[model samples]
Target: MPAASALVDLENLRHDVDDALDRHLTRLRDEVAATGPGTTALTDQVSTLLAGGKRLRAAFCYWSFRAHGGASSGAARDAVVRIGAALELFQAAALLHDDVMDASDTRRGRPTAHRVFEARHRERQWSGDADRFGTAAAILLGDLCLVACHREAGAALDALPTDVGRAARDMLDAMTSEVVVGQYLDVLVQAEAWGLDPTADEDRARLVLRAKSARYSVERPLTLGAVLAGASPDRVAAISAAGLPLGEAFQLRDDLLGVFGDPEVTGKPAGDDLREGKRTVLVARTLAAGDDDARLLVTKHLGDARLTDDDVAALRAAITGSGAVAGVEALIDELAAQGLSALATADLDAHGREVLTGLAHAAVDRAA
Candidate 1:
């Protein structure tokens, strides 16, 4: 129907997913517009949320399909593209709800959806609390995106044989449910007290990080790709085994970026994790290793909303001075090595192994 690249190239895979997202959102826009023009903003906000993703999950799926010897241009490839777009939209839904939960101000260098909606409410002098309205609207937007994700995945699966499709859909459902549960785990960890036992804190943080990020971001996608490609249970397991470690390293990099990354590049403010008092592994390690003064700095400033530039600086100093940064970096390197070693164990073709090796580096070595 339209000119498109059907190759399995990574960059082209991103473009193909974007095209699918555009098609899905166009349908969403038309459907929403049918209700009324006022509802268009909901679709618009979802659109905004979908922009600027790294599409690492999509890449994993696409290449996993390729790695499993799935065809480059055919029904399977197209189905994987739809599934990739579904993953990206699902990620969008997660971000929408996550920002509201974290009370975040920015995403991908733009004001967050809730914040944007809140500003619109204030400007229009809406009656209710602007903050509450924003939260409600953003939540509903996330729900809509979640629905769209399922629909896309279902449609993509329809093209395959029934049994394979059913299993892939099961994987999709598991990924979705696991992420929600993991998010709740994250919330639970953040709300309760910590620092009593560094071991417990690190264990809890690892659980949250793996559930909320590692599995969803990498392992599930890779496993799902293998499933969609009609790989056997053992093959799927192998893919997940290889992907999980890389996923952990990826999230660890994200945790590092949260505290030390530039706002301009990361699209979130500096010291975001510190201000949020994430109780991350980094924080846990700092508490374990820091001198009393560094520990005091962490206790005083972590999660303080009124934190200033100087306060952020001091906190950063404390974290680095405590040696958590280097510790985390070393851990990241170790995990990356483990993932690559696992990948080597998989019976991948040469090209597949090469691509996956590249992706492992890209996932773990990124700045954003």
Candidate 2:
């Protein structure tokens, strides 16, 4: 028997997910190849977007399947991994479009796809304005990603049982639609003319976080995996119970990183979220505290590209002083605790439970 180690065996599972993504991408690229010559940029953008990430959603999907008695033999696990890969592709699509919508220049520590293409166009002295070139390229790239996600998902379920295929399709549909709606809400909130109640603003942000980020990150993937594996509704519910809180904690940590993490580590500039005026739950809560000076500081400094270091320092102090930092930290702890408790009592297999517990710790405890 293999000796037990302190770490979970999720590495092997990660490889499986990677392999599934590779296969699906290969077929997708082939389809793109059949297109006209000038469309090569489209194919390259698709590959670039797929090239990197932590693959958190894929991990969740695989674990959910294993938790629900999914056999690892042959293609059973691979099928679930493929579904997870499709989720990642969907995310890439959302992000590509999101960068364009947000006018973001950077992503994952590099020029966003549109920015890269736009820069290329300028260097080559292309006919159109660089800004328009970037926007057009990003929009097309995002659309291609969306199409690939559906094609990959359909191919994954093509050989599965009818019931399983139906469940997977339903999850894909809901995830796609909800994420788009959440993105719209995020964009509208940035405009800050919604006339929403002050008290409800943070709650609304939380709702968007849950639906847009958290569900796609963990909850929906887990539920979809269990459904595909024919797990009981009760079992599926338990997996969601374990996934949702943990996922939220993950995003809470992300919110903190967006404001404070090192650029070297987070692949984003310091205070990028503030510079973008992202209406994160943390910022919303800080505003809710209604501190007069803090409000003024945020209104003036937040989202300003030309903000000085002193301004960032002041804003950080305001956030910390307003108790929003500590409040969010408390919420992270609570959510992590609740997720672990659910794992302990969940009906999942012992290995699944243990792996998930370790993942929860890593998700919430990491610096980045």
Candidate 3:
């Protein structure tokens, strides 16, 4: 764990990032207000979603910049904060679309955007199908968020040196493209799970984890910060190496939480991933390693949209009894170790090293 001061510093950074996001969104709202009342809901929905998040990406970006000897005051610090805000907006866009794609009902313990819109339609006795209307609205809101993300990043990067700005922009572009492709792969895997090569399930899941979650959530943010700071190539590589494994472990922990964590702690329903039939590494391992009866149990209920509580309980048992839970725990430990080891060799200040180590611990050893 980091010293109290380090933890406080991280918290302060989170507050700064939040303030930046609020200011950016307010400006956006003012600009869009001139268009019409129709867009207000979109901005409101985005604002609501952005209101609550771990802000891990922003923390990683800020600390990475500091680790590479970037200035921590004046315009430099403010520019980094704006870049962090951009990352938050990107995350908002991803979540908005992800909830719709997963047909999820809730997020952060509230009705998902689509579900909220659906209820609004039903209450108003709108003339069309409520579900469709909700989906359309959510999609448009997601698109708007994506545009905002790019715009925010562009503005922040404009304040940097030309080479640094171009590097950050390129990385951001790649990050966005990777996430979209990874998301498509996720949808494809879910659809093809029944016929997917069982031998390749783990590999495929890992690829999706790296692309969809790890890089976007950790590596790219760190790399972007390093780039912005004009870090040496070797130094940038070291940070990325550290971040990638930590990021994967972060997602792996999330996979376990999705099935087994307390809903109150995770801010999501238990077994929601099972309901969505997520072809996660844990699920793939269970399918590959479980006995015949266990396999049958998982196959029968894994993707059932109308899964009852009992069904979820049974599936949970099947997954656990098959030893897949322990397997995933082991993997998380290994990845966390790998990530921490990389950090040991990283050319960073004492504070940077401690904070990154603390973040790795927080990323993996969490209930949510």
TM-scores across all candidates? 0.96, 0.93, 0.96
lDDT of 1 at 305: 76
Query: Where does candidate 1 stray beyond 4 Å?
Result: 1-11
Model 2 C-alpha RMSD vs. true structure (Å) is 2.8
Query: What do the candidate models score in CA lDDT, each in turn?
Result: 0.88, 0.79, 0.86
Q: For model 1, state the Cα shift of residue 225 in Å.
A: 0.8
lDDT for position 300 in model 1: 77
Candidate 3 yields a Cα-based lDDT of 0.86
Ranking, lDDT, top scorer first: 1, 3, 2
Question: lDDT score, residue 345, model 3?
Answer: 88
Candidate with the larger TM-score of 2 and 3: 3
lDDT of 1 by residue, 1-368 (tens): 11112223444787789899999999999999999768999998887778777777888888888888888898989999999999998999999998888888889999998999999999999899999999999999999999999999999999999998999898889988989999999999988988889889999999999989899898998988898888888888898888998999999999999999988889999998887778799999999999999988898789887789899999999999999999999999999999999898997767767787787788888678
In model 1, residue pairs whose N, Cα or C atoms come closer than 3 Å (at least 3 residues apart or on different chains), thus clashing, are none
